[model samples]
Target: MSRFASTLPIASRAIPNYTTSEAGNPFVDGWYADPDTEIYNGLYWVFPTSSYSYDKQLYLDAFSSPDLVHWTKYPNILTTADISWAVKAVWAPAPISRNGKYYLYFGANDIREDGNMEGGIGVAVSDKPEGPYVDAIGSPLIGEYHNGAQPIDQDVFIDDDGQAYIYYGGHSRANVAKLNEDMISIGTFDDGTQFKEITPENYVEGSQMIKRHGIYYFMWSEGTWTGPDYSVSYAMSDSPTGPFNRLAKILQQDSAVAKGSGHHGVIHIPDTDIWYIVYHRRPLSETDGDHRVLAYDRMYFNDDGTIAPVKMLVKDNFADGQMYSWKTYDGQWTVEDERLTVAETAEAKAMLDTDFADLVFEATASIDYGLGDAGLVFRATNLSTSCDEFQGYYAAITSSDRVVLEKINGGKRTTLGEVDNMIELKTEHLIRVTATGYDIKVFVDDLTYSKISVTERSYSHGATGVGARNTAAKFGHVSVQRP
Candidate 1:
């Protein structure tokens, strides 16, 4: 039997409730990817790819946090407007502060060939960390494919010796080169080689390097970026330009959390061994190609120097006064009074923008006044504003004092289970739902026994949400967990 299997239903253990003070996954809002994290002026900074269609990804934004839990966004820190040669698709910014100047290195135009195409990697300079940076070099610094590697996803690392090096590539290839003191041109090696191929095993793209305890850790992303298999892997060596032997995968997709977790950056705290992995992942709630969000988690290394698998967490307490955590389908959803409230509408839904396969969802729900029902929805996809237009499952408490479990697919609704007259209108009641594989269980105020239980396998993975059909509802103390 699976570890989560049980013969009898029971109350779920308390899941951690996130507050404004607590850090959570996908910490920043909007679609972002290829995050590069750094510390400047004693504050944490994150630069990410504006995840949109290549045509629309013409600008870059940044976020700064005094503490990791709270982040302040600086919009349009750099844009194609500042680089006359950079037309579109500017991304994967690597920012470094040196000699009182902040230098931002980025890739642009998805330059596919070595011809006269004016896109590859370029550098921009700003006096401040967040800035209207101007192009340092009027043209692409490394404009052509070197060592069969596409010149993109550049990462800049300054070693203890103060020598700066850049690692970059795409198309299953990787390369490394030294950055000149100007931070705009490539420096040659003692033997006069300007660029060297350092592609390690299973390497696809997104090169990053860091040194700890005199060991150099070279990491990169593997697998297709658009798929769930996209993940981060690493290899270690004594030399920065290394014949890296593959170690193992470290960060990956969690079906119960998110997918396409890759193209990451590492943050090493000053004067401490602490490290954080900042990356991007696609939420289950969204199906767009550019629907990726920036997230971070603590990274740990075993005594043997191998990295442990990263843990994923997603939570929203509605404390930030921002509705970044949910994508509302229909309704006036607001975060007020420390709860998610939906004003009365014929049929409206707001889905948590995170994906999950098997999860335990719990929340305190209350209805104001209406004959309509309000409750929790799970395993949902293809959501719409119209009534019964999504594919998923929901267990709701009707104002008529009944509990209903139903499945929705292709605008069709199927009743799975129901309990009559078990709840009182306008009163707060705990509503909990668990879905494991094909088995699902719902509990009302009482948890000793499931009010409704059923086994169905129509959908295996999707988003979770709260919905109200013709009623105003308030959901508070909400929690979702993987079991």
Candidate 2:
């Protein structure tokens, strides 16, 4: 059986729909980036820079999830009101809990001069994980640039021997330093040096370090931060302080999904080999440099320990009541009872903001009322308020006993192919459509074979979404994945 077949009931709605573990992309709402993920008190926590104008980024927010599917946001968990030296541009918070106290390490001010106020890498402490953290010290920890690296984008890694190390830097330079037991001061290395430059090949910024199987995996971001080529690369070494060699990039922008996919942190599930890369990417509908949203995807490794390329995809159950990643072209959409429902309208359409191509869009759909079809749309573009203004391909289950594959171009609807399939009214049915190049295939409920297949080449690259024509429809467990 397929992985989804064993997880979801196809014949009846006896249990909840298991779609991507009920987790959606951009798992939390709002614009956030440079996510630092940690397991705190049996829950997953992410501390990210509140993406905004530099002057407006004086605070940081936190999100905690018991499971990857559900999240709770703690707004302004830490702000400049608690720090004396930070005035503006507080960026990239890294959080860790130690000795029963929670510590947050962050960079502020984008400082360049030695006497430029009191901003560099700073530390804050709180009694609880979700904290109104206060500055641990009255000043910045590393005030001066070493090895020509700007002191920003700091990440903490705790070794098995109870030693904590910080990897940070920007301006194309990277460094590693040890943290003292006080957790606020730097410690010297074995060579009596306080800072060691371990810059790897193609290193730009966003330094992250992890240890797996006694091997040190050093990762960093590369390329221009504001451009689509921004991505993550890694290197492996046997020691914490290593003769590091650069390796290939493991996370990058998929034009079919989102752009500028970089500045990431890794999370390793306790007692398991499971790993996830929590990062930020720009939605296709957005253009601002600061218009970034936090997202995550499963990370895999080859047998030889090389990481696999991460695929940008999303699966939404709508259980969290967060829909920041979607754009409603025209609809009164609501999320309740784990369903994305659209009220009755001439044509209701809302597309997930990610750009999809050569992908599979799947959702369990049912019509509440009216005489029309409800299903999935792919390569959808030029959407608007009118029913027939969009250009794309649609695969829908009609009110009658028929499933259809359609092509919509400049408001003109063309029925490419259709089949006589039973579409019971007010009954939940799984609808899936795969479009690869010019080939289109639709699968309804039964996944053994395509119910409707056609060759439509008009629209090749665009967004995937849910749509209803002159009807009220509710969709559940909507998913878009690379085919």
Candidate 3:
């Protein structure tokens, strides 16, 4: 069992000026925590819990980056909508791909006791990395907390020998179990029991394991979750299942920048020795529990194979980002080669899962076919259920070269501002919208076209994406920046 609370956080040596841009630190615009990073198809994908309250944390979003710098949010990849047994408290998802299928191991509805699907660790599967993954098993894989381990914070490690194991627990306890080849359920030992208790001393929660050079690096988060001293420590072992002796801490808080940094996942650069730790931290300015955000920095190894002090990246800049859609509506759309295209000329729209309250979104759009009007969408909500429609503000350019600004609510369209300024249909033009407070400003190319200020906060914070009414449009690049 974990020896936390009574065990003080063992701090690391000071790292000099670990810093990055704010937009890069959080990785996404909203609150996200317990991030697990995986490299697939030459892109880095981060799956994190929607850092909210128990009931509100019903969905999980993913971010993809070509480099480790910029990320595109893919929201609602997995949610309570797909799991029949899970209702809320979806956290710490472990994703692995094998046999042409992507398996997501997650903890939901923190099951204090035990029951059918009342809340425990479960598995979901899909064919793609960015997936609308469905529950692979009909019920919680570990529906009951056996051996005093809490059925939460599951992490999966596939060893070099093709053997996979799941590590998890909470309340200062952890357990490990072998996974069957299907990866949907657990395998049993000759004794015919479930999992074995492997909780190391000082472990609190966030069980993550990584094997490097045949050494098992078993790590866990320690300290009270909501406090400034929340940090991470680890133990090393020669075997996956081990009598791990507690090692020194590699990550903790820097009072000068941020605090409460822990619950991390390690991503060793494909075949290189360069390692990075993907974790969450509380920004120095925010004192709330759900104010956590994801961040990454280099994790080095010492001469003796012990983990060196992690250089945690710190940023104080404002929120800004670039995002693309993972889902689309009745439009023939394709997102490849850094461009988004509405291939068919009919009423269709797509929303990039990155939500916002007040920010600027800019995209270069050009019409390729049909007499169609296409624009950018902002503050979009009710994305998954609304008949492929959403509610938000739309800044559009008509096929007749007219600039238009409107509001969309449940498929009902209302014009807010429109200008007769003509711009070529098939020519690429820069479209930009700045929504600050209640005022909305629309721009074409570089000039201000139409502006409107709304009184109602009905759609205060949602997502941003692209839309077209009756035109096939192609957007070269869409970017959102905080101003």
RMSD values, in order shown? 8.3, 5.3, 13.9
The sequence of per-residue lDDT tens digits that candidate 3 reaches over residues 187-254 is 98668866988888898999999988889999999998899778999999999988777898899976
Please give the distance, in angstroms, between residue 102's alpha carbon in candidate 3 and its true position after superposition.
Answer: 0.2
In model 3, the clashing pairs are: 3-202
Per lDDT, the best of the predicted structures is 2
Q: By summed lDDT, which 10 consecutive residues of candidate 3 come out lowest?
A: 1-10
RMSD of 3: 13.9
Q: Rank order by lDDT, top first?
A: 2, 1, 3
* Per-residue C-alpha lDDT of model 2 across residues 1-483, encoded as one tens digit per residue: 111222122223232223223557788888899999887765677899999998999999998765666677788888989988899999999998889999999999899856556689999999988898999998999877999888999999889999999999998999999999889999998899999999998999999998888889999999998898999999999998887789899999987778999999887776567788889989877899998998888788889998888876678878776665677767799886888899988787878776777887899999888889898988988876675777888889888778988888877789998889878888999999888888889999998799987887688788888899888999988888888
TM-score of model number 1: 0.80
What is candidate 1's lDDT per residue for 375-445, written digit by digit as tens?
Answer: 99888877666646678888899998889998898677899998885677778889999889999999988
lDDT winner between 1 and 2, please give it.
Answer: 2
On TM-score, the leading prediction is: 2
lDDT of each: 0.84, 0.85, 0.76
How much is the lDDT of residue 321 in candidate 2?
68
